[model samples]
Target chain A: MADGNEPRVFRIRVRGSDVVASCAETEKALIALEQAVAFPRPLPVNVGCRKGGCGACRVKVLSGDYTTIKMSRAHVTEQEEAEGYALACRIMPLSDMEIEPAFLSPRERMEMRQAQKFAD
Target chain B: MSQEGLLRPGIAQLRVLDMDEAVKHYVEYLGLEFVSKEDDGRVYLRAYDEFHRHSVVLREADQAGLDFFAFKADGQEAVDGFRKRIEDFGYTVDDVPAGEMPGTGARIGFTVASGHRIELYADMDLSEDAPETNSPMIWKTMPRGMRAQRMDHCLLYGPNIEEVEKFFTEVLDFHVPERVDMPDGAFAIWMTVSNKAHDIAFVKHDEPGKLHHLAFFLQDWNDIGHAADIMTHYDISRDLGPTRHGITRGQTIYFFDPSGNRNEVFSGGYTAYKDHPTRVWDHNSVGRGIFYYERQLNDAFLSVVT
Candidate 1:
């Protein structure tokens, strides 16, 4: 349990980029990263679905001390979770960590590119 | 007046699809009178209203769905009513400091029933505005859809459908018009305080957050075809149709914006009220044709990885 007194440190890594920031609690870290980064879109961070059931938001922790809210079977598999993949939206960072976001596929990239061209 | 006591009244307008093509198409073909263009490339569009300036804003982005926008509550009292109800349900509300912009009036902050951060303001002062250059491809030659009044509703994607639905209905006091339960008994809730069926909805999905298409209601159904024809002329008719949704009784057409975000131009939706208690139904209650529709991305259009 977090005591709210002990100063915590966190090092976060966003996917497809090397920008990282360190901050005090998990929420502050997440919010700070959100404000600092110019994301291609709003990163789908977790709301309250911390249990991982909602899959509303998920991020993989590359290296860190963390815990996930209970997940639903439909959202994630035990094997996936076991493979160092934790939902970024659900887990509270306990210590310094690294993370990887499951990015869009190549074909999806093409579509996005085409859409961007049209917009421009 | 205490800022915490104020609730943003009704949705002013929602930014649907961030694509350039979609925004341009709406401006040129559908007859959405262009309002202003921001230096950051954000374009403001509006339908003529008795009260305010442009009702909707379309920002250029790589990903689609409802992006950020504002809401206008009835009065200071309504804003206060929302603040009380939100805190009563255990959530944080704050007053957005002034001078963020020149004309925007006193604005407060609160999360929506669905947990999205939103800003509410009263007395928007856009008195000294300038006109923007008109696009060459104006749809003056063709008929158009209902002059959309304002962006009124935002249908969001919620992976944990049940929890989100509960947050909106119980916490924020929105009326649930219809609920679709999954085979496992989880549910997607449609809640609204507006006369329209729902100002917001919680959809069940695999990926969560606001990764769904956002819509704006045209004044009438004919405007739908007008907008579609405009897109067709632009050679950008990705998709168009009149499909019904079981949850909110909305008839809609799905199309891509220039930025690859999905946008819907809809009309003929119902509303919820306090006197009429909300109705709930079983999961298998509605037909698949009306309730469930295909959301195919064709791999090429998928841009953002979240």
Candidate 2:
């Protein structure tokens, strides 16, 4: 919900889900999502330090114009950002948006499976 | 036996949570000299006493862990030899061309049995600001922070300790100075290629490729105290220590970087010669072996990894 002074409805498309949440344009995309339920369940983005240092909350801005603050070079390389990846915690929503949170890589998936087995 | 082969631990690239906080911890607090920041946002740092262009590279990332650890071979031939040996040990080796990393030459990299990326390279440009070689003053400049002498070694946690032991000792010519064994098998091993007690250590864990801590060499016990004072002043989240490790006999302190990666500053391990007998510890006495003074492991020591 946007206040009268800032009543721009931003449609945030998370992952590949058709469900879109109507959110007010905000400085941080993550904060905007937190205010509105965009998915059936909580978004799976992992976050650590929220100050654009950890790349845990990184997502691909599939089809939206957004601005971002300076982020760490280690997580999102220049090439990655150029390819449309943005840290949700650092991005300012400017228009209706579509984002896909970075999914686990193949290596990570294997590790997760192994870890699950160990835990069991 | 070739006297000239693997010379020393050379490079370590760590994924940090915040660049600013990481810089402050590594530079202002740990006494490393800032070298340069690449366009990719990675910052290079070197200790004041080091001659290499840089030793540590910090990449701001979401998670905290080690990216890779590398050693300097005597020359290109030694690196080539290790590559062949490592490949023969049944691991794929990747050739990284020169200039892939600033100031470094070609390197051969492989993932060891412990699920850690290890690289061997033979060439790096000397730092222009390295301590003066000719008529050098002991005080090249005043050392700062805890006055860390060098990036010493790291302890990594992963599965398959027995395989890792064979890989380092049989393939890489590293020698075990100490090891812990349980009824199941070897629990942990401390290995070295040089005179230092251990160049790298590993603990048996269910998960692969976890960093325990990267240690920096401090001058002595007093320096460890100074480090503790600085940590307290800055309110750094301390994990353990200002205590002695019965394993290496190092006066040490363990603390966390803002991103939750553990960093250790330690001093005073006895010199390890290749001929020294391997010290052994059993599961029952492993706690005392790890922490000599406490004689018991801290709750966090065994569970924490980044």
Candidate 3:
């Protein structure tokens, strides 16, 4: 770690599903989502700026500590940010994390609450 | 470029955490001439080619950021005229007396919709280090470090750029040289009061009064590479570049001052004509619009500000 070649890795467990991913502190959480074997699918390569300019990779972190870069206020308001709304491309995980897509199907919302109860 | 209103970006007061490091960065690394340290502990500086006594000021502060950005008006009347226009546009205007900052004249100050303090003054003492007038050589003394020629422009991040853009063009008489119109609304704008590509630019962000970066003009593209070399040798914390901006066509590099305020060494931008049509960009090309080569913004571009 001192040599700087290796970075600490954290687990990303998507809420409402059993999907699990891993991420490093030096990369965007979206990269972890793409690398996750259990994620729904591969995120489109050209969908976002990979910079904070575009808000294509939005997510709602339910619980976790993660570092973040800047994201547009147009997409994520201060109120929304306080509520855990974030851009996946702008965040890097610090510990085991639980997140859900900003927009989820009604069925998925129900499942998330049910799963969240057990974790809490 | 017009003859009678705001002359150019003249003075900027930046807050720094450490005055010594800030002085080293601006004077030795960025090639600005250190002018004086006032009793208030603020240090003044100017580029070699700037005829004015100073174009930059550094103040010791708890955090790194911009205190205020000021423009030099053609004269007192222009400033007074703009004060009325600014107040009539729904923003309150206040006055700062002359000699508040050494040789500077009185300034009219106000906060824009974006939450940044903007000011305009009409006069400043000529620097003793100004370029020769008669039988003048190109430079009185050779430039050092990055050899920055002048204080060029700054980028600020805050909300409501549309209203900010309107305030600039309408009240300040600045012209829009380029803009990005996203589907939601005006995303960003590059505004100019002179022939240079931009005097100031703004990006839409939730936070108000955030300083994105302050840029210094270099002589040419090769000077940009020289800036990069200096950053590397001195272990300066650099953000991006030795690259070109598609919007301004400038060869540039972004780095951090000792206090974390972003700085840019820029050169080779197109001269903007007042009559020229405003260059427009959309969402799909925003990446290339900012960084021509990468065709995208780096994470730090949006997140890092002081």
Every candidate's TM-score, chain A alone: 0.57, 0.69, 0.70
Q: What is the C-alpha lDDT of each candidate?
A: 0.52, 0.82, 0.83
Model 2 C-alpha lDDT per residue in residues B1-306, reported as the tens digit of each score: 545789889999999877898999889988999999999999999999999999999998766789999999999998888888888899999989998889999988899888899999999999988988898896577999989989999999888989999999999999999999899899999999998999999998876898889999998999999999998897675667899998988889988776657889999998888999999999889888898888988645765567
Q: Write the per-residue lDDT of candidate 1 for residues B1-97, one digit (tens) a residue.
A: 3223223233233333333554665666445666667776666665433234555666543233454445665566766676777677677888765
TM-scores, in order shown?
0.57, 0.74, 0.74
Best by DockQ: 2
DockQ (CA atoms), all models = 0.02, 0.06, 0.05
Model 1 per-residue lDDT tens digits across residues A15-103:
66766765556454345455556744545343222223223344566777776654433234566678766545456677876776643
List, residue by residue over B149-243, the lDDT tens digit for candidate 3: 89999999888899999999988989999999999999999999998899999998877788889999999998999999999898676677889
Candidate 2 ranges beyond 4 A from true positions: A1-120
Off by over 4 Å in 3: A1-120
Q: Candidate 3: which docking quality band?
A: incorrect
Error of 1 at B206 (Å): 4.6
The DockQ for candidate 2, computed on C-alphas, is 0.06
Least accurate 10 contiguous residues by lDDT in model 1 chain B: B297-306
